[model samples]
Target chain A: MRSPTEAAAGADDLAAMFGRHARELLRYCTRRVGPQLAEDVVAETFLVAHERRHRFDPSRGELLPWLYGIATRLLRRHVREEVRALKQVPHVPDAGYDDAAAHRVDAQRDVARLSAVLAKLPRRQRDVLMLYAVAELEYAEIAAALEIPLGSVQSSLHRARAKVKAAMSEEDNR
Target chain B: MSRTDPDLIAVRELPPGLAEPSDEAVARVWHKIAARPAPRRSSRRLWVPITAAAAVLALVGAGIFFLRPRTVSQPAFTTDRETVTRVIGDLRDRAVTAEPVSVGPGQVIYQTIHVV
Candidate 1:
């Protein structure tokens, strides 16, 4: 049994962690699954972190990747929802007539194409790609987050990016 | 390794109205994290058996206190000579003053005696 003081200290540490990382993590989840499910994913991530706080080793890596890893694992349960949301992106109406609006429409089109490609990616590759592109973690951090070899992270990211590029080029051709 | 790739940019750009999490959402999640049950340490686990053993010992002690053989204290009349003498005197006076009955020819008499 942890002393009351030790447990309090652990809670404080987790609260501090949440204060720092919750927003970024929320944004990341929102991108993977829409805003509706993002909050749930973020909440679960922190709860899992609190449950497994004893297993955390600061010497291994920073805390963000660890949290991302937990969120990523939890996201597996919603893979179908996420892919469906991605595939639906292109169909959403784009409404505006201003220059900024035109730019946004073009961006949305590009994003829609990327989302389609992302939906079809293998789980590991998509995870690596999202972590790289959205969370902006370093290769080492991605490795730590996913608990995979550094070389594996590198290769997965490479393959994921290449696939996105190829898909985008094919869209351009059409 | 340029982050400027259009596809990467597209991935980074969130859909309309999807930005940083609202304060309410963050607070809701933080509440959950804060409200989580604290992890029990090994020492805490030891309390269960320790408490149970203490309760068992207490029950055993209570059982011994209640069920053990006891020495009966002597009654006051037996312990005090004056009380015993007084009681005997009263019994004798009552017997001396008791009414006598005529016996029928076929009837048998039954008497109860108290030995001091």
Candidate 2:
């Protein structure tokens, strides 16, 4: 797997760079905007990363966070679609099921419930939350990736988690 | 009994229905990547910003040079710092040794009051 630094040095190395980060970035994008538009988002992200490769400094941070930041900016353009997609409740009718199948449905219901709650969060909070939850970035990484203060990351994550927890309990009650 | 935080629970429990990037997309990016210059060092036109900034600094420096008030430098009273120090020392001795006249025989002062 090529580091972004290597990719930045030469365009040919981008394939190597993409080979490294693309899978995770794709999953992140997919979770945000669903599968259909995820590739478009990732394509636009790498292209932008290529153009702005000059700005990346390995000493300051890693390329993954920088790529996330770039991918996120592109995702912002599709905020409406993302919100709509995330809010979609998979139309799985509840039927008498084996224990494992019932557990799967419950999990899917939780995911759907979380999605609706996530859409209602403030844009800034939602970005912080989704990046943390979906991308699996640490607080420090998320801070660097978002160019926000570590304190802000903590606060935003706190708020986001609280909202998700509250929404989950509400769903459980229903 | 539940020690897990909501976020951790969400991560472990909520599986992502993630979409993989299409092979066509990968190939498209691959071709785009191939079309790029394969040089090891990323090319940055360093001279452009550096030269522009240097020019701006030069212009500002020149502007200050032309616009600021000029000081009139005077010829030194002594040729060197040693000469100036010697002169000051001599003047101090002469000042301290000279006695003031007692107008009424009441006191004799070692230094003159008016000159220094």
- Candidate 2 lDDT over A1-174, as tens digits, reads 456566456433556668888878877887777665777778777777777777877655678888998888899999999788767768656844698888788777778887778888887788888787777777887888888999999899888788888888886896
Fnat values, one per model, are: 0.65, 0.23
Q: What is the lDDT of candidate 2?
A: 0.74
Two-chain DockQ for each candidate model: 0.33, 0.12
Model 1 lDDT tens row, B38-82: 655678689999999999999999999999999988744456889
As a whole number from 0 to 100, the lDDT of residue B103 in candidate 1 is 96
Identify the candidate with maximal DockQ: 1
- Model 1 over residues A81-156: C-alpha lDDT tens digits? 9999888875635647798887777667777878788899999999999999889999998999999999999999
Please give, as one word, the docking class of candidate 1. Answer: acceptable
lDDT at position B62, candidate 2: 100
